[model samples]
Each structure stands twice: as C-alpha cells, then as structure tokens.
Target: MEESIPTCTAFAGHKKIAAGPVVEVAGKVKRYQDKNPDAQILIFDDSSSQQVELDLRGTVADVLSRIPGNQDPDQEKSGPGRPRLGVVSREIGLLPRHWDWLALQPGGASVTLRKLVEEARKQNRSKDAMRQSQNAAYKFMSAMAGDLPHFEEATRAFFAKNRSLFETLTAGWPKDIRDHALKVGELAFHDDKSANP
Candidate 1:
C-alpha cells in the first residue's frame, strides 16, 4: 500500500465524523448512519476537497481492493528503462508551422511538448489547486450552509482570499461547520510563498 494513500473526510451537517483512508471513513459513515438517520453524510477527498460518493454497501472490501491506478492485473510485467512513467502513445493533429517550431526545440517534438506541458502545469499549479479548492468548498457549503447567514459573503470572502473577512462571516455558524469551512478554504488557498511544513 502507498504510504500517502489519500484520505477522505466525512461530514454530516455541521459535524465531521471521520478522516482517514477510504475504507475506514466508509466504515465510520456506516456507523454514523444508525444514529443520524436523517443526517446527510458526505465524504470529501482530502487533496481536492471535493465531495465523493462511496458505494459502501455489500462486499465493500472487495470493491475497494480494486481501486484505480493500481497495477493492471492482466498487463505484462515491466521491463524497465526509466520506470515507464505510465506513458501512453496517442496521435495529435498539429499545424505545419507548429510542428516546424517544435522540431527546432532541443529534445525532439515529443520531448519538447512534454517539457512545455510540464512547465505550464507547474506555473498553473497553485492557481489550479486554488480553483479546485474553492469549487469544493462551494459545493460543500451550498449543500450544508445554503440557509445559513452570511453564506454569500463568506463565499465571496473565501474566493477573494480575505481570510479575516471569511472568518468574520462564518463566525456565527456552528463550530463544526465553521471550522470545516475554514479547513476547506485553507486547502484551497495555499500561499505559493509558504514552505510546506
């Protein structure tokens, strides 16, 4: 198993029930279901902070054991050269001038294109992550706090990167909800200048 196996955090209304591996979180939701029959239990991916629905019923272990991105069972074993990189070959249509420009680059068209893509991805990563985080927060908030006071203001503050404003707006919310909202917001708005702890 991968050490960094992603976690999914489970929430019900204003309360957070679990945060851990998918299986464990699913189990927690199952337990929580009994006592809070009317509650809406939601699971959010920790990295994306986006809501994910789990099929937690019968044979869950069997289902989870087949999580995607695991090695393909029927595929032939690897003969190594740079460890595969999960590369896949595909055809792309490009204008003549585009190909001409790429052909002049240092490594060959494929390598040049790959490097360009990686550079663009690196440049946009923080922005992309922030957008995903905001979207995730918005989805959760819409479901859980649509009726709460300052909802719109809080959302505006969230995307505006005004933490104090966001905090003030959510101050009257239930503690669980407020804290979770803040948590999701933080996940979305990581500062590029800050070092990872």
Candidate 2:
C-alpha cells in the first residue's frame, strides 16, 4: 500500500478516547493518562489496526515529537537517485527467462517491471483493498472484542461476507467497538459492479 500520513485511534478501556492523525491522537491519550494514570490505554493504527506504543512523558509537544514518522519533511534524508519522484532501488530475484523477457521490453528492465507492476495493481485494486480492510477490521476486533459475546460467530460472518449477520451478531457489543468495526470494515463488503456484472 502507498504510504500516507498515519491516522490512529486511541481507546481507554473499551471506550474510544481519541482518533485522527497520530500526533493528535497521542496528545489526547497523554492527557487522558494524566487524569487516569491507572487506566489501560491502547492506540491502534487506523489503516493496519496494529497496537502502537507512545512515549507519554513530558508536555504534549514532547510526546508528539517522540512519535515515529513525526519528523519534519525538511529534515528527511535524501537517498541516491530521484528522491523527488519517490523512487527506491530494490533487488529482485527473477529467473533467466523472466530477465530475458524484461530485457526485450521497450523501456528496458526497470521501466518494464514498473509498468507490469502498475498494470497488476490496477487489475487487483478492488480485491486488494477488500482484503486489507477485512484484515484491519479483524485485527481490531480480535484485540478489543475477543471476549465479547458472539465473538466467534461474528468473526465467521465477517469473513464470510454476510454483512447482515455480522451486524446482528455484534449488535450486543459495546457501541464504540461495534461502530469502529463497521467503520473500518466498510470497504471489505464493497461490491465491484464491473467485475460482478
């Protein structure tokens, strides 16, 4: 997936405390921690739903400055080649036949490889997006709602693409958890009309 500004959500116990850009979320979490020192706080990346740890010591600016990916763009180190174009060189292992085919293409190996990758990404965009959304939703659900009632059935329904059944099974869950799950999982059920028709 293409990199974007990191968005995240923070939960204090079962209630969502804050959400938005990572720095903003971290600031809110820090304030909440100041009020309720004993409260368990979990911050999750909105895109990946993976738990994140933040250094909450010191002032809000201090905390925000400590978060990863919060660096100033001007301070970013430029690598060799075209950094402005966002190109990075990486090694790939391809068989001789594949190399031969790439060599025969109009733009040589790198250009041909980039074109092929772009085509494949375009073709699989919907399916890829759906899978990513499902995975993110599952990660969040497993972390927050694992012990809740109908957890197993809800998971099954989620993966099975039975949106109605999934909603039904999660109806009794905490409002925050249910709402967030649906929000993150929304794209998982997106029907590609062109592909389906």
Candidate 3:
C-alpha cells in the first residue's frame, strides 16, 4: 500500500501563503502568524477545499503532532490480517442472489467484491475526478471569492462546463484566488466524449 500525504493550502487574506503537505503548510502558517498575528488566515484541504482549523498555539513540532495521520507509519503497530495491504474488514449486506453469484467466483466473495469495486472505479475514474474537481472549486470559490466580481456568473459557467466563459468571468478576481480556482477546477472541464448532453 502506498502512503498518501494530505495536502493543504493557506491564504493570508486573499494571497496564498503556503501549499503542500499539511505539515509543511502548518509550519509556514505558524511562521506567518508569528510575524503577522492580526492577518486573516484560512487553510483549506486540497482534496475537498474545505476550511481546516489548525492549532497554531504552540511550537511547530507541537502543531504538527496535533495533525491527524502525522505519525510515522512504520512506528505504528499493525493489526490483524494483511496489515501491509492496508485492508480492513467491514460488514456489507447483499441479497441472496448477489451472494450466490459472488460465491461462484474463483477467489470467493471478498476477492470477487474487490475485483468488482476496482473495475467500477477504473470505469468511473474520469467522471469521478471531474465531479470532485468541480466540487472542490465550488467550495473554494464560495468561501474565498464570494464577493468578487462576476462570481455568480462564473459559478453558472462552471457547472455548465463552459470553460471559456468561466475563465472570462473569473479573470477580474484577485490573482491568487483566480489562479487557485482555475488550477483546482481544471479537471472539471475535461472534454469526455461520452459525457451526457
């Protein structure tokens, strides 16, 4: 299993101050806060574009310790069954017919379920990514650029998949906000030939 680090971005007022793994961003934010205590700072998770509050009351190492998943994975004790694979057991319900079908699969129910899930994920990957990007952009825009010019129109163009119009509308926004919006929303405008009209 590959380790995935959580990434975040911090903004001081409308200008982005830091972006990268949460630990790094937290360090930057700590220093920024130390120098400018009165400045407004907002931190957002890169994946969800949701605002995250960090405890900036202590030393950099203390701040990092409070962050979830900051522990060294190697130092953590492993639990039962294939810890290296990062598999967790969970109960799932299925109809009798579904169970019967899965039972007949060569690797049994667990393996068959995993294969089916992986196949579906592969098939839906592009659409999933596009939706996630749109959501992330919308969340960030609504929070940071709500009062910016043409925000409403830009939002409409965004959902309508009108990249050109969205770009034009957001062009007048603060440089950092506009750039971050465009970067996160890039995949939302993917030209998938099979996309519905």
Candidate 4:
C-alpha cells in the first residue's frame, strides 16, 4: 500500500488497513472490518494529508464512482454549444460599473470573470488548503486526544506551526495517535506556510 506517490491511507487502530486509490482503500476497509467488526478506521487523503471519512456501507462500485478520476463516461461527451472546459452557463448579476470594467478587458465579461476567479483561487489556494488541513487534523485530534494532556496547547501550537511544541505536547499520547497528530498538524502548517509565503 506504500507508494512513492501520494495516496489515501486508512488505519484501523494502530494497523494500516488500506492505502492507495479510493476503491482499493475502500476494499481494504471492508476486509479489515469483516475481520475486526469493532475496529475504528480513519482515512487520510494524501494530497492534503488530512483525515477523510469514507462511508464503507456503500457498494464498491458506488464508492469508486465518487472518486475524481472515476467520473461517468457519458458526462465527458459535449452537447451542442456546450464548451468542454466543464463550464456551466450561469447568470451572474453584476453592477453596471462591474460589467463596464469587465467589458473593457480583452475578453468578454465571462472570460474576464473566469480569469478573475482563477486568479483569486490561485491566490487563496494555500490559505484554503491549510484551513482545510488544519480543520481536518483538529477534528481528528479533538476526537482522539480530548483526554490527553496539553490538548489545548497542542491545538494552538498546531495552528501556529510550532512543530516542536506540538510534538512535545503529544509525546505522552499513544504512538499511533501521536504520530498521526504530528503528521496531519505538520501538513496543515506546511500547507499554510506554502500558501502564505
């Protein structure tokens, strides 16, 4: 399950139950749960390196289809007058000045708006990513480390990117939980830094 490329990793308690594609990861969870009915499993998305929850109650096919790469084939076929850039026509209400400003741009209003949106997304990508990662890690730590020592400080240190302090605070935690907290917290900090820097 360990690949050089990033992939989702799932753990049932301290044991890694699955790691790879969503389908493969889901399958592994199924198998693991089949043997250990009471085991708690947590999933982590590789890109954000944050915990992700999978509803294993669904069929394998259903789960696979939800993954990004497993989109339905029919959805790829373009209809007449429909651009293939996955753009959907939607009406946007803009003030007269806004419309005028957009019209002055080289491209039409739609193109200008699209460019603006893209630029904003690029500008906020790191902040948004870090926020998501931090939230995910915080959710996990809150659930698992509520009873552990220095929980609040650890959380603050987590957002502050004080990795050494975070590690020290979590040192008394269980090995598996401690390691995961550090991993996800570090990821959030790194993402935030990369975004802001």
Candidate 5:
C-alpha cells in the first residue's frame, strides 16, 4: 500500500498547494501571507506540478515592497482577496531615537543584535543627538503616506466589509505593529473603494 500527501492542498490556510514560476509564486504568496493569518493562497503549475503553501500573517504590502519591480501591489492585478495575515516581529520597542541610530547604521540588518544594541545605547542624549533623533524619526515617519487619498479609500472599504473581523483581529496588534497596521488599513480603504466605486 502506498500513501501520498495531497498534491493540491494548502494546510492551515486557503493557499492551495500548486506550482508556477517559483519566483512569481514566491512573490505573490510573500505578499499574501503578510496581510492575513487565517487566509490561505493557491499557486499551481500544471507543467511541473509544483505547489506552494502560504499562510498570510499580514498585509501583502511588505512582500510587495521587497519585490523590486512592483512596489505598489494595490495598482496591480491583485487577484481574489483573501483574509489578511498577521506577522509578528520579535524586536523590542524602537523609538524615534532608535530609528535615528539605525538610520546612521550602514548595515544594521546584517550586524549582530548585541553590537547594534550596544552602539545605539552608547550614543548620548545630547542636543545634537536629540536633533538627529528627531530627523530620523521623521524619515521613518515619511515612509508612510498619510495624505494619500488612495489610503483613506481602501481603509473605508475594508472597514465596511470586515468591520467586526478587522476590529477583533487588529485589536491585538503588538506595540511595534500598531502604527504600521493602521497605515495598512488606510491603504486597504483606498483599495476597496477603488474596486467597488
């Protein structure tokens, strides 16, 4: 008797276990998982019979950001929308000052966390540092588009469609992700509105 793992089934989410161009599938699911937790995705290639499993833990925005060519997923042919995923970062609270120090860092991501923390802690709270910290915080803040009309629109749609779910799921957002999640809501509002109206 021979047992077989289901070929086109995605576990723990709606993502189907199928295959396509590995890179594209990876890119798609990367964004898919970033936006939802209970949502699953499906990617299948009939030729090679490859499959992928994606558990969206957050908005697909982060994945879109990393895709190089297309930074704006909202403008693309975003296929059927699935429940957004929830992504959790293990890092500690990062204030504006921390962000400033990180900005000055050449390659903070690759550096050892201990070393990075030590360097950040070593910087004194002088007037110069304070000014620099303010600048850095502003830089990080600028990364998010508050006035983008699209942002407001997408959030409105999501709010109208998934009011209860969004509230319950978003309520548990960790300290580090609260602001980002809010921004995602803003973008989603823009997207949803554009789609329907």
Candidate 6:
C-alpha cells in the first residue's frame, strides 16, 4: 500500500480563516474561507502522488520567474512593463513576448490550444485591419511609400507572411501621412491607367 502523499492548498481574498495573501486551502484540519466573491469553485489536481505546498505569498509572478525560458509555455518575451494579459501568459506557463494583450478565448471554440492560437490569430487579423484604418490622412505615403504595396502584395500572396506588424507600425501614423498617401494613390492609379490605355 502507498503512503498518503502530503498536500497543501492556498487561499486568497478571505483572511478571516487563512493567514497571508495565500493561506492554506488544504492542510491541517483548519476551517478556511473560500476567497472567490462569487463563491466560484477553485479546483486543483487532487493527485495523491504529488506533494503540494501552500505558498500564500507567491503571486503568479513568483511561480513564473522560476520556470526556465525553454520550459515556459509562452513563445513571447517575458519582461517588465508587460500588459494585463501577461498574467494569463504566466498562468499558462508562458512568458510575454510577441503579443502585448493576451486573452484566452476558446479555441475555434475548442479545448485544444492550437484552436486557441487560431482564434488569437483570427482576432489579431481583424484588430490589425481596424488599426490600419486608424491612420492619419497626410504623410501616409511617406511612411507607407516603401511598405504598403509590398504589404498588400505579400498579404494577398500569404496572409501568414504578415500579421499584426503592419498595423502596429502604422496604427499611430501621423495625420500628414494619410493625406500624402491619398495623393500618392491617385498618382499611381492615374499612371497605371495611362500606361495600360
């Protein structure tokens, strides 16, 4: 027969029962208050083989800094000044890198992580499209002169080749760029028609 494995659980929010930011949720026979304001059930693995430690003081940050970069589930960069989504990334054992705002939406509405990525990508594409439209009206061509057609051509050829990068770079373009872009577009269109005619 296997000896009983020791376990410890941490509770947050309600201190009347527990001691620190994190109090033992499971341990010696002590009455602990559930932290969730809504009384939502917080579940953890009840494995008998694993030894559990109740770290009340350890924020998600503490657990995150321990995992090796390669071991981190996130492919993105983990650094300070990270956004709110960084919490999600860390919770999922990932370090913030590429995406600033990380949200966990259902995968293709599926349970699989790949489905989650697909959803993230789809959402990113739409966001980028919206960002691109938020451009200023002048000097747009100056900024986009070397990049827009290439982006258009590339995206038309391979959407994966470009994702949120263009929008990121262009989202805050100066108002002058927008006006310049329009003028350039008109000239280019005229030139194209004349050449073809």
Off by over 4 Å in 5: 1-20, 53-197
| lDDT for each residue of candidate 5 in 1-197, tens digit (9 for 90 to 100) | 24333222222232233233444555556654545544545443222223343433345544434543344556544333331222223556768886677767766642445575557655532433333323332332223223333434434434464435544544443333334333323323333223221
Instruction: For model 1, state the Cα shift of residue 49 in Å.
Output: 3.1
Query: Which candidate wins on lDDT?
Result: 3
Could you tell me which residue pairs clash in candidate 2?
A: none
Query: What TM-scores do the predictions have?
Result: 0.69, 0.84, 0.82, 0.66, 0.18, 0.17
- What C-alpha lDDT, on a 0 to 100 scale, does residue 85 get in candidate 4? 53
Distance from true position, residue 90, model 4, in Å?
6.8
Number of clashing pairs per prediction, in order: 0, 0, 0, 0, 43, 19
Model 3, 17-62: lDDT tens digits are 9999988999999999999999999998987899989999888888
Per-residue CA lDDT of candidate 6, range 36-80, in tens? 334322212222112234332345444434433323456556565
Whole-model alpha-carbon lDDT for candidate 3: 0.88
State the lDDT of candidate 4 residue by residue for 65-88, as single tens digits.
666545776776565436455567
Stretches of candidate 1 exceeding 4 Å from the true structure: 1-4, 34-39, 59-63, 69-85, 88-96, 103-110, 187-197
Candidates arranged by TM-score, highest first: 2, 3, 1, 4, 5, 6
lDDT of 1 by residue, 17-41 (tens): 9888887777678767756778888
Q: Model 5: what TM-score? A: 0.18
Q: What's the lDDT for all of these models? A: 0.74, 0.87, 0.88, 0.73, 0.39, 0.33
Best by TM-score: 2
Q: Candidate 1, TM-score vs. the true structure?
A: 0.69
lDDT of 2 by residue, 1-197 (tens): 66678798899878999999988898899999999999999988887899988989998889988776577777777877566687887778999999999999998998998898999988887777777788999999999999999999999999888999999999999999999998888888666542210
Runs of candidate 4 exceeding 4 Å displacement: 1-7, 13-15, 44-72, 75-96, 121-132, 187-197
